[model samples]
Target: MKYVLFVYGDEKPWADAGAAEREAVYAQWGAYESLLTEHGARRGGNELAASATATTIRKQDGQVLITDGPFAETVEQISGYMVVEAADQAQAVEFAKAQPGEVFLRAVHDYGLDHLAPAEAPPGVRYTLLVYGPGGQETTPEQAAASAQEHYAYIELLLARGAFLDTVALQGLDTAALVRKPGVEVLITHGPFAETVEHLGGYYEIVAKDLDEAIELAKALPEPVVEVRPVVEYSG
Candidate 1:
């Protein structure tokens, strides 16, 4: 199986750390990347721009409204992602455990574009755009309601274009449980894995002709920090 790892962290800590501390973190990442390569697990990966540069788009009635910042207001944010092939979810979690940040691991499923309408050409492979940002736990009821309405409209647009495969929105990071193994013992921890301003809010898998098309779709999404990754097909 292949898994998409959404990496989240409090960017501030790294940004505010001393030069040596920063270098240490980078070294950790380098080692983790090497591990993936050695295992022939790495497929694709990327680090996103800061949340401050994100643009949130919404189609209301006949107008397309654009917002200047991220959809959710939070401290920790999505900084990067990696796609890797693992034997199963356990191995996937182990891969994430070796990384430097909190990782929301998800299995990838590719639904070919052949079933689309004739106007929508089939793509060579499906792309999984991992949606990462705030969990909206701090938002008021009214604000949450409005955001949901706009998000649904955005989904409708993708569905209409024959690009939608499936989407899953996770609950607040507070509901997360972490599992780990030391030797033969397994350890489980509760609450958000990392204490950051942002959380693994949700994700969407869409079919596209290539990376460019996937990015174009991501750019129009209603969230900040979209990590586009190719879904690896299962040979087993």
Candidate 2:
């Protein structure tokens, strides 16, 4: 099974930290990455730019409304995510427990779209579209099927435009687990993280010419809200 570890934390502290502090944090992350790589569990992942750099898009009254900022205001925002292939939920949980800050782990729902490769750099800049919607809502079989078809069609459009890099659909929150490190020990809690009106459902990573083009492409997502952020690039 594949799991996504969503790393969340308040950006303020990092922004206020001195150069030495920032380097220390980066070193910690490097060590974490090494651990995952050594275990052969790392599949793919990326660090996202700050939430303030996010561009949100939603369809309101048949018009696509674009705005600057995240979909919802929250104390801690998502900083990055790591995708890992694990034997089962238990193993995935163990991986999360090793991570820093608050980590939300969700199993990935395979849609057989894993064969798609991300576009090359010359094609455009990469952006991740964070899909959010009302969680724990029950839907009939017919409704579920309709939603799947809509998503398939939308994905086809992205593929034709060469904008589709990778996409992931997560299982419901009931199956999610949250890992938090407050002190020397890591606390693990089964999720339904909070009683929020919106919850992150999944995400789409795509390459676009620029922000405007990315927003135009994101408008086709069949979701209530899509928060688009540029993927950070690091030189080795």
Candidate 3:
């Protein structure tokens, strides 16, 4: 099974940390990444730029409104994510428990697009389009199928433009789990990290020349609200 670990935490402390402190944090992350690799759980992951650099898009009154900042205004923000291959939800939860801050574990919903090439664009910067929507809504099978078709069409457009990297839809919050390690104890909850009406539905990873191009591409997505954030690049 594939699971996504959404790492959420306050960015202020990190932003305020000095170089040494930041490096220490990075070292901790390095250790965690190594642990995942040793366990054969790490598929792929990336740390995102600060939420302040995010650009959001939403359609209102028939006009697409482009705004600054993240989609959610909360104390804790999503800092990064990891896609892990695990045996089951239990193993995924165990993986999440070792992560820093609070992690939302969500099972990946197969949309039958796994065979698509991750990317076709030339080497350049990458961005993640965080898709948010009103959760806990009921939909008939026909309606769900129609919605999937629309997304598939949009994805095809992305592929033709050589912008598609990867995409994943998440199962509903009912199957979601929150893993937190405040101190010595690990706390696990069987729901979303937040109680907001707009829950994170999924995300698209894409490559673009720059932020402007990324925003332009994000405007083409079918999601009601899309938060575009740059991916932090590290030289290997």
Candidate 4:
């Protein structure tokens, strides 16, 4: 089956890591990637920028409302993700747990959701994963940035798999676009989503063995912390 591995966790620590430390940490992932490739397990994936650079887009009343920061507020936001072709949810969870990083495992999921109106989800196959961090667990803010190095490989493994789907990443929250709307009174504000915990960092859409298999695959998803849900099919 295919699974969207929602990879969430602290970024600054890894991103801030020294050259040597960064290289070593990511190097550990090489073995995991090879394991997947050797077994023909991964599909595809991608690395995300910090939430700071992300632009949230919401379709409202025939209009695409673009906003700033993350889609919601949270501390452990999605940093990156991968797509894997696991035999079942168990395998998916295994793959997720194996994701390379330093933060104590945070969260994992299979990934899903019903597409918004006017936006028809692709037909072929795809998985959706929202990455987030565990509250009170992620280390200091600086360390969060340090761990971003593993993102490159985390994404590449899925690309290696055959079920790779669409991927979107954030690059650090942008405060300039903050705005509040009241009828015609749209007030722009400066801030980010949840400053504590529970925010999207990035996501992966993929095809898995089957829904049941997908659930197993999600069980193995990696962390900061996250949840998984199936895409609600709406054929209107």
Candidate 4: segments with Cα more than 4 A from true spot: 61-63, 102-236
**TM-score, cand. 3 vs. native:** 0.95
Off by over 4 Å in 1: 112-236
* Candidate lDDT (C-alpha), each: 0.65, 0.88, 0.89, 0.49
* Higher-scoring candidate on TM-score, 2 or 4: 2
lDDT of 1: 0.65
The residue-by-residue lDDT of candidate 3 on 11-65, one tens digit each, is 9999899999988888888888899999989978779999999999998788999
Quick one: best TM-score, which candidate?
A: 3
Residue-by-residue lDDT tens digits, candidate 4, 1-236: 56555455566786689999977876876777787898798765545556664444443465444445555555565565566677765565556556663111112232232221113333443445555544334467677555544544444555455445554443333311222333555343433334554445555565555544443333334444433334423355
TM-score of 2: 0.94
TM-score of each candidate structure, all chains considered together: 0.54, 0.94, 0.95, 0.45
Best by lDDT: 3
> What residue pairs clash in candidate 3, if any at all?
none
- Per-candidate alpha-carbon RMSD to the true structure: 9.3, 1.6, 1.5, 18.6
Any runs in candidate 2 off by more than 4 Å, and if so which?
119-122
Q: Count clashing residue pairs per candidate.
A: 3, 0, 0, 73
